[model samples]
Target: MSATTPLEPAASWYAASANAAPERPPLSGEVSCDVCVVGAGFTGISAALHLAEQGLKVMVLEAACVGYGASGRNGGQIVNSYSRDMDVIEARFGARTAQALGDMAFEGNRIIRDRIADYAIDCDLRDGNLFAACNARQLKGLKEHQALWERYGNTSLELLEGDAYQREVSAEGYTGALVDHSGGHLHPLNLVLGEAAAFESLGGVIFEHSPLVSLEHGSPVVLRTAAGAIRAERVVMAGNAYLHGVLPELEGKSMPCGTQIIATEPLADDVARGLLPNGMAVEDCNYLLDYYRLTRDNRLLFGGGVNYGGEDPADIEALIRPKLLKVFPQLASVRIDYAWSGTFLMTLNRLPQFGVLNDNVYYAQGYSGHGVTCSHLAGRLISEVMRGREGRFDAFANLPHLPFPGGRLLRVPLSAVGAWYYQTRDRLGL
Candidate 1:
């Protein structure tokens, strides 16, 4: 009901360590293009790059600086698969849908690698990710997950137990782990910024600090910002949780939630090597999971905890420091250099919500917490649809998504209650 203040990018470790990005002027006057994209994060930049490669004129509009949203602020793990796993998709959406999704499960990982190589975008690309299991039950689940993924041609997964787990991660806790050789980690902010640069190199135009104010849908969609307007043949909405009040139809389908992370001062090479022996990104198997990895400079970046109402905690370090200590008690004396929070959108089904609004308007949002790789996949799929290859896009768009219960008023509270239930199960080791 009331206008909220705009958010500036958090003073995160990623921001501090980011490569220098040239300042791009904001929109000022009228501009027309073949396609106008809202939100200059990964999805928008990726889509713009792909569309431009196809010789289409494209323009990207960002509410803040590029990668200022979750794209730049995320934990930086290149985790493959969706928020909902393949078995869950098979059970709920049927085997046909699961099969279709399975075919693309690893495409995101491949896209990230190909983009880095093709564009020579430097983002500290590495080669492995680990999933740690807290208890025996979680270890069993990991085994089942490995087998299920193998059925989908993910043969790069290797299950580890006992001494093997300890060898990979020198943590005190964790019964076992699953190493995904294909998945990895990177500097997310740099990755997005590099992609944005690549997009511009393709003759695509981008305007930063140009938030969308209003939209008039018709034969040629007209989108207006405070000081500028764009008339385009088509529009792409990739703003996700940060998109507020632009479209009424997207209101109740997803709610914004906050997640925090802390980065410790660069550890000694020996210390960093001791923490993760093989230098793989790790995430514990819990509903409220803890994911940590070593930055290129060896700073231990650890993240966990969530706020369902999208409110940042008074002290992000205080809230997340304990979680980090729990995993690596050896880091009890480590100085936390940076702490920040970012928001991601969650849908009722935990699956991404993708569909067409009008004949020429398309949207892809609600990646939940599994956005890093999926956002890239979304961009490619969206571009394909625009190019008349609709099958892959339909696999996701056809899935049904329910509105959050209680609409705007009670959705946060209801979701919090649900989260608590699952978190309790995670705690009880059920």
Candidate 2:
């Protein structure tokens, strides 16, 4: 009944597929740095990489292994816009602010692609993404989205209809689709490992298995762990859902959202090409979207089936097989080889939250499912702000986010009940 319950480390295809990552020893002694980052996911690793590149003494503390958080285990869809739709942003924050946010989301996509190329990260980079329309309403929405994208001079979004959708992805479930060149997919765990390696390569210190259990804020903030501690001029809370009491003010702003995925054993290369010859990531346009892509080995890595109650259903394959079969019924016989889940934070507004509570206390979270791209962008912005350039950080900091309703005790249940309603709606086509 509690969504905050820890998710078991389900066997993930990424874990089995990625190359071995270099191991950093756990923290054992006290250390000092200009900045200390409190998570080992994309944001923390990225910030460490950027900060170290700028010649700053940075230390990153990881509660678990690098990429052990949602960054290592996600749908791997590099979306082209914010987690919340543009209309929602414009309705809440006016047209100008919404447009700027949209532009930033676009840039977030670019950041991932550029980073992969610059770092020579081999993460099975794909070049296009498809937003499939499961119903007529969604088809019309995709058209409207295409028009708006063109109005903003985003010509990368192409409206696919009729035979084109069937031809490109070899699927008949969607009424139509929107293809965005700006967005794509990659091997998420590999990307995270490569980023961590890049950060260390640039001389940043990373301490694995060093969870910060206590904090003392001042001119030089102190972060204490079981075996080690860090005293630094700046402290960044980037733990997302895995963080607890590292900072009190950050507690109620977001709820941990649990999502699951399954991957089939490799299909014949010709079979995969028959299914999706274009080699792009495909996700339906729904409240709880079913996202999937072909792995480099030609396996269908499908992700769907969300559980807000933090209880993974006993029959996860049963719960999600229907969703998969709905999209690609032709592949109903494919054997599912791996299934897993990860918790990512989600705000009520679904926009990312960023700011400094005090001068030396900086934090960013609530990226929802947009963590892959936004986390990288967060690192860039945080690095800029750390170097006395606060323009980009302030842009994201200006966005408004409301705390969840029930504080700690009831927030999970409230989120679960609300998510159930949404999932039900998704099932019933509301």
Top lDDT prediction, candidate number = 1
For each candidate, the alpha-carbon lDDT, in order, equals 0.90, 0.82
lDDT of 1: 0.90
Per-residue lDDT of model 1, residues 257-348, tens digit only: 99999999999999999999889999999988889999998999999977986789999999999999888888899999999999899999
* Superposed Cα deviation of residue 151, candidate 1 (Å): 0.7
Model 2 / residue 216 / CA error / Å: 0.8
Q: Worst ten-residue run, lDDT, model 1? A: 1-10
lDDT of 2 at 205: 82
Which candidate should be chosen as best, given TM-score against the real structure?
A: 1
Estimated TM-score per prediction?
A: 0.98, 0.94
Q: All predictions: root-mean-square deviation over Cα?
A: 1.4, 2.6
